[model samples]
Target: MQECDPDHLVLAIENGEFERASEILARDCQNRCVCSVSALQVTALQVAAWQGRIDLLDRLYEKGAGVNDVDKIGRCALYYAAHRGNVDVTEWLLQRGGYVDAKIGVYSCTKGIPYTSLTKACFVGRKLPLPVCWGRTPLHQAVKNNHADVVRALVEHGADVNAKDERLVTPLLLAGSATDRDDLKEMTKFVEIVKILVAAKAFVNIIHPDTGTTALHHAAMLGSAEATEILLSNGAWPMYKCKSSGSTPLHIVASTGSTETLMVLLEAMLPHNIDTRDQINRTALHRASYRGHRECVRALVEHGANLAATTKTGTTVVDAIFAHIPRPLAFITEILDSCVRTTNNSPLETYDNVLLAFGYLIVGFALSFAVLFHGNDQFRDFWRAVVRTVVMMMGEYEYEELFSAENGRGTFLPITSRIVFFAFIMLSSIVLINLMIGLAVNDIQGLEKEGHIRRLLKQAEFVAHLERVTSHRIFRGNWLHPRLRMLLHSRRDIPTKITLFSRENYFHHVNHLVESPSKIPADLVEALFLLATKTFHKNDNLTGKNIEIGDTKLTSILSNLEEQVRELKIHLSQFDESEIVETARIQNKACTKKTVNS
Candidate 1:
């Protein structure tokens, strides 16, 4: 028998040549082994599946064509058919004893069956030479592409709606992935598909293997209020923080400034969740203020969000914004104002009081000088009286003037007059001067106690500026002319390369902008990947105390050290009297005792 080219038969099948496909299959030259000759899995049945050719599919199967054959990526003919939304062909294959969960060549030794159980345990997570399908069923493909009819057909044929792929991603979880929801329309389709899956009793809270994110997390990240509401109504727990982004649904909307979606999540979370913080101790209000979402800040404030909420650095939202915006948004004026109300004995207030005291001191000096100079002949000039009083206040007034007067003025001066003059000196030089010093010292002490709050307010103002500008670029501008790039140029908070817009306008030319890696530099990419995974451990000169090079645990350690220092400072601040001298004496005695013992 002449050898038959499987490519020709595949081409015939792809082009809808049912008779030619039948003729080629009937000849004994073609068989299941012959399908492997092509570069990809393009056997007669695989091509029929790709084109949804049910007639060619029936003939090929009858003539010994493999039904569950998979292509290069562990995807079978059933996968191809389901991916293409071929409901009839998928139904036909299902009825003809085809496996609904067929992965490419499952029974082959390449599937890792020959390994011992020990070896299996070791390499279960590691990939093999020929990878088995992540265990995704045909239903996974149908749900992914928004083919409701195909999904319904696959489900009715006993396909597992909750089938876990190798990554532990379920069909329902895959349905909610953001890779498909690129726009509002696409997001709506995903909601419809998810509704179908939920109707089929698909588990909603499956923690995905790659990110530990649940279905609600994905829906929230996708910015779909309807999908989020649907999941939440279906008893989906929205509180679980995704380990990948370190965020819940609330954090997602807050970061993106999705005001409407934010309202949806906020309504669901309600009174118990306004100040809920993430891994970094950043609340939704913190995220909103950091991004400058005034409307979100307003809503949170209305719900009585803790305006004093702090991040890991103990910085309030008002402080976070002061560095970014010249002035905070008008909506967050209340939060900014709370900066004055929140802190006690702040340095800024103390500095202001000290200035006011100096201003009042000038008036007091003028009045006292005019009164003392009133019944004297030579000291009648206001300027001369001011000069003499300033010298007397310093205890530098000359007594020689009373003893040697050229006009015989000292001979008639009374002793009782001297007593009255000395009384004025006591009040001006001793009493009021000491009182001024005491008040300034008191203000300085108050500043030492609460200076951190002023800085926090400044930081809050900086980040709040960013949030407001970002919201404006999205919500304020004309929809036909979305000024997305304006955010990058508006403030230096977000970098120039980053973008927040979900879609680009039709006329906007997105030049050589690499949205994704079209051509990956494999060696460099692999080297980078290895650099991240490679262990960087050594315990040499540091006395066997090691630290991960890129680990963030050091931040916590530093923060704890800062807190300890703060407590020590506070404890030491109370030692302002004779106790400090006593503490020094005790230290000296202890040193003497240690010296004697040595």
Candidate 2:
């Protein structure tokens, strides 16, 4: 009839005193509830499970210890068993109807027991609140600890392979997570675990709730070629984009500069996705170039990644490379030179034409000056006239010399000849010289504008080049299947339809295409406008109509629910606070009586 503390049973189990623990449980089974926990808030069953004492676990369970009773952290006995890799204890708990997929913070005591009264039960039914356990299942703990046997046991017992934690990360994602230390044995163990989970049909593409990354994303970030190959082989989508980073596995691997893992992912990646952009609108090649991963950039280029692809800020791959390494090595320069020549139309060529035009103007002026000053001895010879023209062009020749008799330049010249001199000076010095300078200045100003266009052209050229390569006879049998390859390589004459919801949406897209810092083609702008105009109705027609926010059915349902809430609030307002509390108290008593009767 005396009271006994739960710590006595917990200590008995901890000390491996099976007889004393059983005696306490047998006596406490009638006098006290085994669910009563110690100062640490851990039940005796949880201690026995953690200690892998199958005998004590059975005794505590038979004496009214809930198989799924939780500790302070809401971890149940099975969770501790799985955490400790106690296979026998886990199997015993599972046999006793323990929930295998029980998460850390969930209490299963009142689960599936509708008639059970919380007031009659012990601590577990109290609903003691705790923080998030990341929704981790017993399987997550087993996988995290690398207990392959326990993982197998949990899976064999119907553990949820796709059970996600609070982060929306699946057990498979946790198993494939990267670590800072690259222990071969540790990685090998995880790879085996991944194999087992995949064999059990785990969803490989489950995205992280926050990061929107999958198992492949983490594996790529890990730079593990073996793990990447396994995931890719098991239907992992290589081009699956992350919502947070908007990066594909290829993009993730590129940032790490793992050429081997990149190659593995690239093998699984579609050719069109090789230049896929991330959240910042930069491709894997851009990421590689920015990180100064020369080998990664080289590999990507060989795989047909676009070197001309620009970031959202108008930074080309070459620009990124130069920004990271101001002066790169010879091979990087060579690679750049080859692609730059193919894409870039240098201003130097136009400058050469301007220089040639200037030369012709000088020669033409010299011939005219020679004819105009023929009567003067100084300009009698054509070559001598050329020398004078050069000096005059430099602003060194004096106008007094042209009119002075002692200089013998133009003292005896006719009025027509003097007029010719004035015309020549104005045309050659002011008009022609300034025109040349103006052309050079205009070219410099056009460079920035031309850069955006040049990138577009280069991208076009790259696509065309890829089309030609893919369609080549050499790649006929060696590359993709004939039909799939033809489908991908075939040119489309018809444009795809794009829907613009509103006038703002339409203008936003048009402005995006026409923005000064990164201008696309005018034809592209025109095409977008034409497509929108033909596909959707005019804004004028849509002006008076109210835009729907959500699904009409959902909106109607929500409105009905709001009406119900208002009615409930009005009905509740009829009763005073004390009356409502008394009603709840009576209902609780009735439920407790029913539980006691059951």
lDDT of 1 at 425: 70
For each candidate, give its TM-score against the true structure.
Answer: 0.48, 0.47
Which pairs clash in model 2? Answer: 134-166
Please report how far candidate 1 places residue 238 from its true position, in Å. 1.7
Per-residue lDDT tens digits for candidate 1, residues 309-353, read 888989887776554333454335655565454445555666677
User: Any runs in candidate 1 off by more than 4 Å, and if so which?
Assistant: 1-4, 11-42, 62-66, 69-74, 95-97, 104-106, 109-133, 178-182, 321-329, 334-598
> Model 2 reaches what TM-score against the true structure?
0.47
Report backbone clashes per prediction: 26, 1
Instruction: Give lDDT: candidate 2, residue 75.
Output: 80
lDDT of 2: 0.72
What residue runs in model 2 are displaced by over 4 Å at the alpha carbon? 1-4, 11-33, 38-41, 53-66, 71-74, 85-88, 95-97, 104-131, 144-146, 164-169, 325-327, 333-598
Per-residue error at 286 for model 2, in Å?
2.0
